[model samples]
Target: MNSHSSDKKGILRRLRRIQGQVSGLERMVEDDSYCIDVLTQISAATAALQACALALLDDHLHCCVADAVTRGGDAAREKVDEASQAIARLVRS
Candidate 1:
């Protein structure tokens, strides 16, 4: 496969793992686990999600966003705005 497809597959794998972590955290809460333990699991899940998001953002900046900028036009400006808004949302979370 091409490199883009390979990167998407890897990202999907990480997302699935994060999904499992979230499920496990739900189970922990259902089991009435200690407050600190539950919070810790939540923290871990959040970190995993953030890591995946950051990885995707890095890839976009390096490839898609870079290409858009190189093209140089309204489309490039739009892409930059879109990417900036996305990063802002991610940071807010």
Candidate 2:
């Protein structure tokens, strides 16, 4: 198995930042901040979340999926199928 210690740290950091963004959004709404400002922050949070998801997907492709593909068996097909479905969902989002 591959160790993604650094990847994990980066992801956790991103999540923490996203959490702070959400809190700020909440405060903005509570304080009746300008509509466009709130909307802009929301967009920023959404983009950050999507970026984090892509990073996780990239890690999965490079590690688990790559290993399964190299094995050339049922595991490979399953991993490919799994990755395809994940990609489709992300695209739909």
Candidate 3:
């Protein structure tokens, strides 16, 4: 199974909820909702997305990347490099 398959349903559920929040934000803008209220929802949606991303990153480190390292040799070294690049990219973003 894929490393994230176990949490797929839960992750998808969270994504769908975030999608709904975004849709609501669109409606809020269309309806001219208060600025603070819309901003609050936007902040919440951002937090939700960030949370999902962190969870997937954690799973990748613990599963695929860890397994690659255990395999040893060049492949392990490559996986480490790949993980480091991914982390750097995430931090930069």
| Best lDDT among the predictions, by candidate number | 2
Q: Write the per-residue lDDT of candidate 3 for residues 4-66, one digit (tens) a residue.
A: 555878888889999999999999999999999999999999899888877777777788778
Model 1 over residues 24-77: C-alpha lDDT tens digits? 988988999899998998899899899988888888887777888999999799
After superposition, the stretches of candidate 1 with alpha carbons farther than 4 Å from their true spots are: 1-6
| Candidate 2 C-alpha lDDT tens digits along 45-75 | 9999999989988999988888899998999
TM-score of each: 0.88, 0.92, 0.85
Q: Candidates ranked by TM-score, best first?
A: 2, 1, 3
On the 0 to 100 scale, the lDDT of residue 56 in model 1 is 86
RMSD of 1: 2.6
The local lDDT score (0 to 100) that residue 20 gets in candidate 2 is 100
